[model samples]
Target: MKKQTRAIASTLIFAMLLGVTACSKKNSNKSKKKFSVATQAETTEAPSETTESTTESTTETTTETTTEATSNPLGLKIDVPQENCEIQFLPEEERFKYDMVLELNEADHTVGGHVVVNFYNNSSEEWNQLCMRDYSSLFKEAHHDGFQEIEVKEGALTEVTNVMNETTSQALTCNRDADVSVLWIPLDQNLKPGEHMTLSYDFKATIPLVADRYGLSDGVYNVTNFYPILAVYEDGKGFSHEAYYNFGECFYSEISNYHVTLTLPEKMKLLSTGVENTPANADGKNTYTIEAPCVRDFVFCASENFKFFEDDYDGIHIRLVYDEAHPCGDTMDACAEASLQAAKDSFAAFNKAFGKYPYPEVDIVLAPIDAGGMEYPNLIICTVDAMYCLTNSYESFPYEQMAIVVAHELGHQWFMGIVGNNSGMEPWLDESFASYTEFVFYEYLGVEDEMELYSRETFDLTKEPWLTSMQANGILPINRSFYDFEDADSYILAAYSYGKIALYQMEEILGREAFHGILREYVHRNAFTNSTSSRFFGVLLECAGQDNADLNKLIEVLFDI
Candidate 1:
């Protein structure tokens, strides 16, 4: 975990017919006192009692135990007494047993956080508990089927409240560096390792106008954290818990197969993270499954009045789902084609440069939400209005914005998807790297000189004071929190503007051949595993034979803070 600067949130006031208001929340901040520990112990047996009063007493005893365990603020624990379940990336059908349906409230823009995972535990041990680390900060005990809330001390958990009123609360007993929870206990009452268990819990999430995790605007549903996805419990990274993360730290996990079935209204159209297993008009329902393996978590979108289009370019299936009656229909088509082209270019370049494209199909859908674009494996949910609304006048807007935005998302197929990153700790690994890759696609399109010329021209044209003031000061380092100041531009500068400049500078320093080799080798080395800035910089240093570079300083300056 790295130190981060504070993020300043800004509200976007767009006067659209749908009463849309997309706000951007920056993740930035630093905390000096935070820590965790690890412990190993035998499974505690459910103490038997002689009377109902004894059962009540036992419950009280458990509560007291939890209170005592959490009395020390620094006391938390991570234990792996035994491995009860083994999760692997198999074909979607073989890996998943049921379609995950998340019921969301359109009125409040909240999600039904109930997770029903029908998975099999193939280990031979008797599995009793499902361990999951807490990611959000404001969680209440959810009363749902097949679940129980193990009580811990108050204020013992961290709250993830980036989205107003929507935070996942965590209460851990030990002073473990990471916060974790047993989402479901006893894989099953009479469960053997190879048997299956179905766990379901009802939850509610706060939907922000501009949500980095998940949100909705108008009919467009940006369904992130909509379902209860499993956390990465690995050997080295541990339970993947860092309760306080700024924009710098994004996410860390290995890509697993996703077989999700989203149930929405009959009037809605769906766009998700995998190939559509069912036809578009499958009785107004869309079912998708991954045809190839994905290396990260899944994301999806749903909307009414969404028009669909598809193109099979060089065996890669590309689908564009958006509003059909949009005034920018032609621009939408152009963007769709541009997205496919970017995918083609990225895959071709990445394969030739590093490894192969792991997934078989990719989808790019236009979301109604106005919070810019978000990337998922084989799919990207971006706001159509925002992409087309760059210019003051529709006629003045060029189609290049569409191309560049699409290219950025497509770049994630490598930076974020194939080559896994702990976004919460090293956001540059995804955003900065992805932005740089988009620039590479720009070069592939023979627009490198054109884009750079425009950049130089703009640098000269823009006022220095304005640029300096616009530089982000609210940038918290990765794995840190946006705990201080409020300068929203830091989010853009760190992830987009300065990040692009830094990568371009790296290219100049390493030379084109070695630069590309370093990137390719970095992806190859860390594919399907969480990687950090030092690891990435080390690759560059190895290729460039440079030491004492103070790579972290480079990232800090990227925000121009």
Candidate 2:
């Protein structure tokens, strides 16, 4: 989910130690020269005139909509039509929605929550049980003392048990595998198809002091995946009970509407996934109500020392939250406007190439993060280190790194946020696409030369070497589960590096216009739902001409399918 650059020789030596020799003999005949820097025609040429005309038309429509929606172009709010905001990609009957009330205790860094979910049985088969992912328990299992207490308040369940709760006194009847992030609640009766059921949960958790998706670092509190969320269910496959993988995303869910209320200290400013309504202050605390429509997940960040800045792009509100004491605080403040504009341009280019971004606002926050950046539905967290490097007036610092990170995360607003994927199984669906989108963003800005330089340094120079080394060592294919890799580094090489290479090879085979057309169709079809590697390959085969033997060979080489 984040971009990382490591040395080449070290990676190869590590891969050899793992006994990855499956592809060694096959790769022996291949020359490294085949992975040379992209040619001028491939990297710097402007898009075709048709693509330019399409961009202009889309920009015009966006401008008209922006003008009609707001008198002040820089306002912090934009009104989007209800129907346009719906998750139209999924069937109307299958949508699941959530109503939650969460109280954050700033003094103790704890959260207590109550959530009511209206889950529709969209599958033809009847349901005998429901499963929810307890992501916070992963922290507990890692020796962090955070507690994830879940009690079923309302549902058709005969009994509820936290199969992973080691401290609970409940009778242990369920299996406890090495992966223990699921809560199994059995239903008293089989829920018929086309019927709906309401399930409510009361939960509590402590915020760990760590640099992760859900934790408190310094004075900022980041809360993500802190609640028990319903797992996506298949008729015959049941729920995807993938264990939490620390290296990559292991969670998957359907798009759902969220109405959340958070009670926190009055002084704390909150930036969350949804639109915040007017806050009510009472007894030294403020209760904020946020409403998010058709989103896969909800996250929030709170800081009493946070400063806020806002801008607008085509009626979409852009806000940045940062602490002045942060290492990149001054840099973030100085570049906030430029960063937001870059994001807008990125969105425009993505919309022109893929599909329209179906949200009215996006919030970018500079925070302490474990990665270069992380993306939610309408929010992105840029790491303080990246921001600092971007702003540092040093010759050694890579100034373009910050822009690439921002663009990559914003790319996820479409890739992972809207067009969903099981990141644990097919991380390339988001990571590789987002990485490729960074190049697209650069191309859209008429900075193809810069993109080429970046690509050479990142992919061609650094990642290609490691990938070649891995290929020579016969490493695992890119399409495996997240935890199947030896470590995070291997996953990054497989998912991000080789994944982007595969996409680029495909683009080279199919012209740019045709490649983008396929991507646009993919977005149009998969928005608000999950996509698999097979479906992606099917789309590629459809657009790239299935009879193309070279393309088929490339796919086989990359995915080993």
Candidate 3:
């Protein structure tokens, strides 16, 4: 989710970095390390998985064809090369895949689905059992009957585990509740490294009517992390079974291919993570199929009253959907255009500085929420309040605020979406990069002065006073898990505010061009893989020159390592 005030605080700190003359002396000793920008010709690659053909119209017909087929159901050309379309970081032998079919009941506010997973035991040790997370339980805890009826189909040997209740002590602060998210599936055979296994299960849940990520709110159904996804299995550390925290994202998953079919009422409009393929309508229900490769997660939003608009920029299709009766209708239309333009402009800037966005389209939706925004792989959900100032005059909408949120979420398409990181552990890796990208957006627009004023106003209202108040209370280290923070405010301050400041300081030491070059190289090397703080620091040190003790010192101070 977008940390609205934190973005402004980060931009203000970046502006402060420009005036730090003391850091100029260390920059004269340039490193000899070479970094080259990737050419457009190098971006084309084939998908690692085989393509399957499916029917798209009302009559459900089946056909066998490759992605090279000239005509697609959507009438849009499938021109992105297969290799460039899918993530190439993982070896074919070690890749995991998911095939799911979901049916949505709009009247009951429920979803029923089944997923088949082909999982590879990539870890070195033999495994006796596997674990997956049941995030819907978190929602169930609050609205007892609302998020109910999750069954692991009779054929699957999976059961809910309450191991946390049995093993943990009272002193532990995180995830102390009785409802555990981990689901243990006993393996009939001991699976060794490089071995593959297939598992299938059925699940159903009632969507809560709340203004949160995974729920139904204001006549729109927002589905995210609703299905049971495989938990990350660390080589030496075992499966990560951390409970879902309330403040920040606690999700960590490997890039995988997805084939999802959602059956819903015929009149509902849908926006999902992947590209929509052949859709068929039968009786009162419509079946929509989507195929996405190399995405970490899949999500969708459906509403019968949504008004849709479309545009294209730099070979990427951009679309916006919103409720027509919204209080900020006129302003939202204007903000949507401005936000989409900002996103397109930022994409070009980021592609030059980092890496190209591999996806074919991006969907931006005006969701009914009171905060900033939320980011998915190729989709972004911006809150209504961020699109327009609710209390201010309608003539002057919150275009700048909406633009910052749009650019920030777009930045995640690279930092978090393409270059993966553990959000629960090191959220700064993505949030800080996203915040810095917002600064780049303003710089690209040549509105640094306007950004400064906006930043100052937000900083004054939130960070400026909070920092002074917390200075006496002692601040936590910036590089730590979300659980380490005392509250949402502390998390925002450390992860978003201080985190971007650290990057901006690093940018000051290395020139802007060199800094951008380093990030570009980093994204290229670590695309579709999880990155750690050590590897990030090592890359910086290598590019800045090992002999540059001052840069290392600054890193040590900022990251507290």
Whole-model lDDT per candidate: 0.46, 0.63, 0.62
| Model 2 ranges with Cα > 4 A deviation | 2-92, 141-178, 386-399, 450-470, 473-476
Question: 492-559, model 1: which lDDT tens digit per residue?
Answer: 45555445556766565445545665665576566665676778766655545544253334444433
Candidate 3: RMSD over Cα atoms?
A: 11.6
How high is the lDDT of residue 331 in model 2? 59
Consecutive 10-residue window with the lowest summed lDDT within model 3: 30-39
Query: How far is each candidate from the true structure, as Cα RMSD in Å?
Result: 18.6, 11.9, 11.6
TM-score per prediction, in order, is 0.59, 0.76, 0.76
lDDT of 3 at 128: 73
Query: What's the count of clashing pairs in each model shown?
Result: 48, 2, 8
Q: What TM value does model 3 have?
A: 0.76
lDDT of 2 by residue, 1-561 (tens): 554222223532332222112112112343122112222222443332332243344334533442112132221122212211222334445568788888987666677677777877777888777777867656653432111122211111112233221212222233323545687666655668877777665777666667666678778888887777888877789878876654467768889888899998898898988678668999999999887767899899988888887754434566787776676656555555545555656665676677656655677887767666788888998766653445473122222334556777898988899788888777888888887786566555544432332233354422456557766544447777666666556677666655665676566566555676667656656778888888787767665566787677667656745
Score residue 463 of candidate 3 by CA lDDT.
44
Instruction: Please report, as a residue range, the 10-residue window in candidate 2 with the lowest summed lDDT.
Output: 150-159
Q: Report the error of model 1 at residue 163, Å.
A: 25
Evaluated against the true structure, the overall lDDT of model 1 is 0.46
- List where candidate 1 sits over 4 angstroms from the true fold: 1-213, 233-238, 243-249, 279-292, 325-331, 334-354, 386-398, 450-486, 546-561
